[model samples]
Target: MKEPYEKPLIKKVQVGLSNKFGSVYGRHLRPEIDGVPISDLVSRFGSPLFVFSERRLREKYRQIYQMFSTRYPNVQFSWSYKTNYLDAICAILHQEGETAEVVSEFEYEKARRLGVPGSEIIFNGPYKPLSALKTAVQEGAIINIDHFDEIYDLEEIAEELGQPIKVGIRLNMDTGISPQWTRFGFNLESGQALDAAKRLVSGGKLILNGLHCHLGTFLLEPRAYAKAIEKMVDFAYELEDNFDLKIEYLDIGGGFPSRNRLKGIYLSPEVAVPPLEDFAEAICDTLLSKLKPNDFPKLILETGRAIVDEAGFLITTVHASKRLPDGTRSYVVDAGVNILFTAFWYNFKIELEEDISGPAEPCVIYGPLCMNIDVVAENVQLPPLPRGTRLIFSPVGAYNVTQWMQFIRYRPAVVLVGEDGQVDVIREAENLNDVVDRERLPERLILKKS
Candidate 1:
């Protein structure tokens, strides 16, 4: 067999570059996932399928839990439901002794459905409506008040229930993060957090038992956590001195990053992202040093991406190839931003299904969406592979499933690959009925044909 011919062009070659497709060839050409062939998955589940490694998911949860548990005396991990709240994913973490961390009433109900007791749930996020607050208060869920309004709502709920409700106030501080996430919680530097604490104490209906703060997401610096912990601990001591509030816990909210490299990050994830060990050391060292030997509060981590990102993969097929007016090669794939929503931020690791031996060129990978922003990757090096060639995109297990939208095309099916090489469909692919199930046709608009 002869190789496909190409219109050759002159270009400068980079030093030490290999015949591989991309500079990230180390992660290129994944023909299989967890001993299951990509073709087999696509054939059974169809293209643009989402595959998860149950083994990797369990391993990540254990690894992070162990890292922090060994360093801190009482460390609790709360699985962030907003990350990937699929029952399958959540069940896996819950089975690993993780408590549920929900941001809304819907998530709270999901956790409860999974048999997570209300007392075991950590409720975070802004905009908890009256109904949500009422349910949370009655269920004994650990509620973190995000604003003064939520504080007021909870107090009313506590009074209505005729009981003392324990609550935590979310704080935002200048952890040296620019464009800081000051939107969610009370500000510590401006004394907003202290003021909120006073409100909780004076109100008498709510008890301030915990202190919570989430600096930002995709955090690369472990020292940032150390600083946040220091502030939170200091605030706890202040509460104890002035309001006699012995803070029961410190909820260091999750922002730990996955191995996926950010868009503007100059260094690779291996060098740019600090290891979990560094984070555990930074947080635990600060906690142990500040509190007394027996007075250390429960340290809770709400990590999401770091634990599940690497465990997910998306299998897409090349639908068509085109040469742009600028002579750049591009491909139209089945998966798009609608399902791979993180594509807007993360440039996932792209690999071919099989080895395509040819001169590689820089090309663009586009999704099936008609929108201009439906690009999967740009200027990625790849060989000129024909249509129907499957490509694997990975580390997409974090937010895609939760944040994905049902747009012009149907969302694909999701499968979980077990440790013994068995496969199970966790989510079925969407169909016309699934899309139009809730839609209703007006009586006047109904058409009758002969």
Candidate 2:
């Protein structure tokens, strides 16, 4: 006979959550169902956690790749490493058969460690150390030289090695983009680009591969790229005619806009930016019309933000909330400008995770940092949020992690949410020991401590 079981006591927990905009999730801004909560993650790993959605990442990658591949015969995406160089992110892109565009030797080494072939990698940027240039050349990477100094350096290195090194020149054209004439590549009107090409062809140590140029970042205008392509094709034609060398690839450097919303921009994601199809059509039409059918160079795009921006979400817990003397409410979170550097340029829409019926009110969001410039959001209308509430900041997957500063605090862990909604910690939160691992103690200080 089974013994009678005692009545089990039930406990009810009440938790109120809210955002300034009166938007909330059913409970909290949990990244995954049946997965770890922000609070629990902080308990185990700490606060200011960055969570990447693997599903979103793969989806975005496929969308961008398909957008170009479906329209253009030959299209390749070289992931921009400087955007976000997290090993896990790089590995994911590499696993997807995406090539890499590295600006420095360190990033080149990183790509090599990920098993990416140097031939598939495109070495770009204005300033590459001698060691980096030597390594890239020895590895047979497509070196996109930025200026005449770089050209001279490559020539010197090649002469020293007693071999011809293949390289490309970055052309700066009047793409009609904002902040125009920024110091970077060779300007088209200045004749410097032509001079550089001439010097490369005349020099026996260098092999001119192709032309490269990036107008600018966050470029909403597709026509700019179209015009830029027109100029690049003309330059390529000139190089072929002048040097009798066929350009193998035309690397249109990456600056494609991500899903993030910019300040003072009212357009939504659907209409604000031109679709990848538009860019592909422009580039393909321009190149196909300009170059002979047999001379069509392999089109390469070094996209960073558009490929990975939507893939990441930064989740933080509300530490405290208080009403100011001026009757304004201020909410403090575990994250700040350190990790969300893009917040300086964007108005990050923070969403609440719980449902609540309340009028929206203007509130200031502050990070845990003590600096006055550490404000994340100010004078933004938000739903009332109390302490212990979790908030979700979407579309932070691009420049945040790469540009984040470890000021007044250690950085947080980065987790990847799998397709099945399972969470895996891709990067562990930094500990005190991590900050001091390389630090050496003086004998006097050590003696005092002892």
Candidate 3:
């Protein structure tokens, strides 16, 4: 009896405003990135691999640089290290002439180890220990004072070192943007930022050269930047008038959105996110109008996410697929929130390597972690992706690697595909020894069991 096998089928009731067609498998879709097949990458590097494209990184950097440089004559980009501190990524930015913007002493040391001069590094964030501040001040790094205490700390350090240091004051302003980030810097509206400047000038311990402000992360509206630029210009003028100080540079700080769609967002990122030109235009237009040609200060931009997010791809394999008791489909994959931390906030777009055609059903992707919160995608419409199927998650080049937690499994290797299609392992996969190497064992606790 030679009977043909038939696939098992299940029906799902569509919910509110569902895309019934699911992912359209069309002729234009090919699962090759940078001319290399996804299957080949998986087979060679192993599943749950992180692939970064050098071409994409360079292209994005150049695009952003051109966009801002064409408008502002003295535009400088400082790569924010906390976003993605992989040495390879930082090296690329350094090679492309980007200074490093580090928030911690560890990150500051990392930049120095990478041969980034102290003068080129922008040391930010609160909680810079006295030791770190002394090193930064002595090494000539641009330290942006976060609060009054930091100003006092720098004053003490300047006194101890017997050398006056140049510094910038991080300002917090009301730009009419929702959910303002007031925790980082001095408040501008309340005149606290001006007071900080006055203190610095009166102390004769630090040289105030720059004004820094980071509005927020993942900013989508360009108008917010416009308003912030206007306020910054006005504030700089006021500081110059009050303290008789010339602002050397204005650090707008990074908040540019990538192409990853937020979890609660209905529309895809491509449609929702504004182009890079919009942000540049908003900032450049405001600066050009406010400052005279003779008074143009060097513009510093700390662009982290927008420069590298689209260049990263995560390749994971589907380990198991099953139907829940409630008639909903579920997929278990090797990658989880432990590794792909951005999954908690972003609904990352997943693509299948092979052609999948059938009645697409809504499925929830679960990571291999045992925790209840280890979900990757809440609800994505996809066709039947059985066991051993490979799926690629895109635009994950930002915070995932830097903030990934090492809980259950070892972190995987990260490979960078060169412009010539040559793949190199930039970060090797961690082993059990790598995880436990830093542990200390007590002799009294080391006993042999019978």
Quantify all predictions' global Cα lDDT against the true fold.
0.89, 0.79, 0.89
Tens-place lDDT per residue, model 3, 185-230, is 9999998988888889999999998999999999999999998889
Candidate 1, superposed: residue stretches over 4 Å from native: 1-27
Estimate the TM-score of every prediction.
Answer: 0.96, 0.89, 0.95
Give the total clashing residue pairs for model 3: 0
* Candidate RMSDs in order: 2.4, 7.7, 2.7
- Cα error of candidate 2 at position 134, Å: 0.7
lDDT tens digits, residue span 17-109, model 2: 454433333323344423545556556655677888777788788888887777667788899999889888988888887999998888899
Model 3 stretches with alpha carbons more than 4 Å out: 1-10, 13-30
Model 2 residue 438 lDDT?
Answer: 96
lDDT of 1 by residue, 1-450 (tens): 785666765655333365442244332779899899998999899999999999999998999999998888889999999999999999999999999999988999999998999999998989898998888788889999999988888878887889999999999998877779999899999999999998988899999999998888898889889999998888898999998878999999999999997876646677778888999999999888878658879999999999999999999999999778778889999999999999888777788999887667778999998899999988777887788999999899999999999999999999999989999999999999998999999999999886
Q: Which of candidates 1 and 3 is the stronger one according to TM-score?
A: 1
- Model 2 scores worst on lDDT over the 10 consecutive residues at 6-15
